[model samples]
Target: MENGIIYNSNLHFEHQRWKGELAFWKDELKFFNNRLSELVTRWTNKDVLAQLEHYQNEFVLHNEVIEEMLEDIEEHETRIAGQSKTGADALDTQMVKKHLEFRNRLETQRHIYSELKKEFFRFLEKYM
Candidate 1:
């Protein structure tokens, strides 16, 4: 799966990048939940609404990133299919191979994010 670009190094980088992103979002989600809980405890904290709105916006941005990644993967797959029918040359073959590897990595990351998202919401729902 390394495509030979320093094989294990690239694979390790991909794994680290994926896990780092997952860790970031997981932390942000937890921070929002905790802040919301703290705000709920105070009687006169009326500005916490803005913080929640910020969290919502951040969530949307992250969601968009995921959606765009999915769309890109789909686009690559379609391109690969079309290129094959057209007797793709060397460059096209290389592009398709790269796309397939990327899609595989992104899909794996997506699955990890999904499970983390579910856990985040489940915990927040308990407080809500």
Candidate 2:
């Protein structure tokens, strides 16, 4: 939701969900930044490389899934905006279906993030 946007007829549940996800990602980035920095500072060369590999694999999977979902979200929002102005076509219907599918994947990714966060904390507790 935009800063000044009100809960009017134009409001969408999808929009609210996306807004919450965006905020979550922002917080996740900051947490990752600080934790990664602290990890790098304390680990030895070989341990650092191994740790980097671990995080790299985890981050790559998360990033790819998140990016794909975000792309679908953007495409869906564009379709909705365009159709509202000029009416929906067959492609618009397809976009709506794709959007629903992507939203499910987005929710799955959120669960994945929570699991990865737990793994991260466990790693810190055992190793650091």
Candidate 2 ranges with C-alpha deviation above 4 Å? 1-11, 45-49, 87-93
Q: Model 1, range 1-128, lDDT digits (tens) per residue?
A: 34533232333344456556655765766676565666466535445555445555656666666656645545654554565567742234466467458758677767765775675466456545
Expressed as tens digits, the lDDT of each residue in 6-111 for candidate 2 is 2222334665678568567756756775677687777778976597568757866776666666676666666666766664333334554565576677678778
- Candidate 1 clashes: the total is 0
Using lDDT as the measure, which candidate wins? Answer: 2
- The lDDT of each candidate is 0.56, 0.65
Clashes of each: 0, 0
Q: By summed lDDT, which 10 consecutive residues of candidate 1 come out lowest?
A: 4-13
Candidate 1, which segments miss by more than 4 Å at Cα?
Answer: 1-47, 87-93, 104-127
